[model samples]
Target: MAKLVDLTKKPYNLNADQIKWVEDTIAGMTDEEKVGQLFVNLFFPGSDEYSGNEFTNQEIVEKFHIGGARYKGQDSVQVQGLLNELQSASKIPLLVAANCDSGGDGATNDGTYIASGAQAEASGDTSVAYNAGYVSGREATALGVNTNFDPCVDILMNWRNTIVNTRAYGTNADSVIKYTNAYLEGLTQSEIIQCIKHWPGDGTEERDQHLVLGVNELSVDEWEDSFGRVYRNHIENGVEMIMAGHIALPEYQKALNPSLKDEDIMPATLAPELIQDLLKTKLDFNGMVITDAAHMLGMTSAMRREDYVPLSIAAGCDMFLFFNDIEEDTMFMMNGYKNGVITEERMTDALRRILGLKAKLNLHLKQAEGTLLKDKSELEVIGCEEHLEMGADAANKGITL
Candidate 1:
């Protein structure tokens, strides 16, 4: 009768009410089941059919019992079917999420209309960013996708950052702040939660963390200018979750360990001093603070030096995200937990954080004794006339060129 819930102790960290909820939920899990909540993987179900034979994903889903899956480029009906399958297989309701940050197109392509963040800037309408996020939220809801990870709040001070160039609203701090806040506002308005990201800001360094764990050499003041402005505003405006970037800041070096030089902590993902000390503690983000993607170069040490996840979670990441090739890394985390490197308390912490968000967003389905999501036609919510008009007007406002 020993269950995963038994592995987790009577949670005392949360309020009395929350602790009660955690206890009730934890009681249903086995040790392996509890460990699974530590992550959300973004698996591309190859060619999008993802049905009949879920192909290779079956192993990851069946063996791993993952907490959630953040899918990419999955068309509408296919997404519904896959989600239905996932929910049925899991003992607990799986926490399903998607990118959908710019527009819901981040997931459903044709199902959601697209908006160029650059175009929104050229349009000079801040509301455009808001509307874009709103449209993303509405479209995602139609397909049963809830958590929207977008409206990247990076200042994007470097025009050459290819990954961020168009995705970001613009180059100016004031404009980025104005538009990002509006974008978050719109996403929030639609009853969907927004995760404003690349926290501590992804703007200072020119390199993409996706390819390299880029370091920001700016002084504390300069670093603040590049990233702080917009993030401060994001927090003030109530963006619920903020993602930590892989980029490093030389200025916060001493905080990482009053002794080690900048070379020792090139990537923030693995450094608790930088992310936990500087970000979570100093910034006081009481909400969820998640990692960018564990599989990215930012979190991965060189193939020879690869040892970051244990330290990353200990650093204060509430959740770790993985895009693809998930098994290897997920195994590492699970093994770490099994070995005591990652405590059950830590795994439970992530579960509580992720589940807490699901609850907050009202993503858990309602009034459904039976309605095959596939049998439904909710995909029509995206790009409908009302959304398109709102998007067009907002795009016009935020776009500059």
Candidate 2:
């Protein structure tokens, strides 16, 4: 096993009180609760009357005790109210997250729409990337969202990669590193937990992980020169979390353990050799490792639903993203722990990391004070003139053609 980082240190930065809180909180949790902390379910935008999804959302919170939620495009006030309700419903404070890949607009329709990574790079000013992150963080934080799954650091080397075309920074590692770090800097300054993503890199493969498993065919040396270098830089710089992609790297898998058969190769989301051996052990990424959405074909096609949840935790993933059936998945995890498929030690480790992230964001502290969003004035900053100008300025300077 890779030596786990001292949880109370730098990146996590838990004080003695916070440490005790996390420990006590974990100790108080039931197996079901602990398993619930390992998921970040999708939050549809609307109230009970309007969307009818609110009841299910409440059930996910009250029953499953979900750790976090991801929201995309909703009325700012309604979204905030929904999040507050969800947070209030949970015993532990929820770590609200969003697909703020491009900017805050990725999460909400009212948010500033900044230039995409490719567009940002075209301006030839890394500061635009920083501005993008800042705007994303500022707006997301204003709306009570603490996590942004963004700064897509993938090197778009494949011309045929449709999904990553404008999403990625650029084709080269140097540019990706520069822009990614700048973007992270902006997010960090705004106090939004940034998740650098699509680990082992994407865009080298033409296939999308949502439909089928993709492969980044780089050999060990090539990966180290490109994607490896970028990821290590972020990890060393104390990135809070990483989203492991559904893609696979056969070369790295073969290099790590040559005995593996062709059928054994699996998406990084379910591959212990990839997630545990490669990312945690070899890469020494002690921070949280969240899987890409389990509902995707890349994951579902590779492994059965019941097997993926427990196996993902056992394979060193701290959280599973999305859900096909929230209640069913939650039950599967609870049973996994009871059946000894997911060990207590493993469950504890996952909970510790999950709570540590919550602690890092001081969600526990916020929950205690009942001050998730201080005042509506914070919401006023969303899509304000200054932010829109920043987005427009970035586009004016960054867009190539």
- Each model's C-alpha lDDT? 0.64, 0.82
- Please give, for residues 231-257, the per-residue lDDT of candidate 2 as tens digits: 888888988888989888989998998
Give the residue spans of candidate 2 off by over 4 A. 2-5, 47-54
Assess every candidate by TM-score: 0.84, 0.96
TM-score of 1: 0.84
For model 1, give the 10-residue run with minimal summed lDDT. Answer: 1-10
Cα lDDT tens digits, model 1, 314-346, are 566767776343555666666677777666676
The whole-model C-alpha lDDT of candidate 2 against the native structure comes to 0.82
Instruction: Return the lDDT, model 2, position 66.
Output: 86
Indicate the TM-score of model 2: 0.96
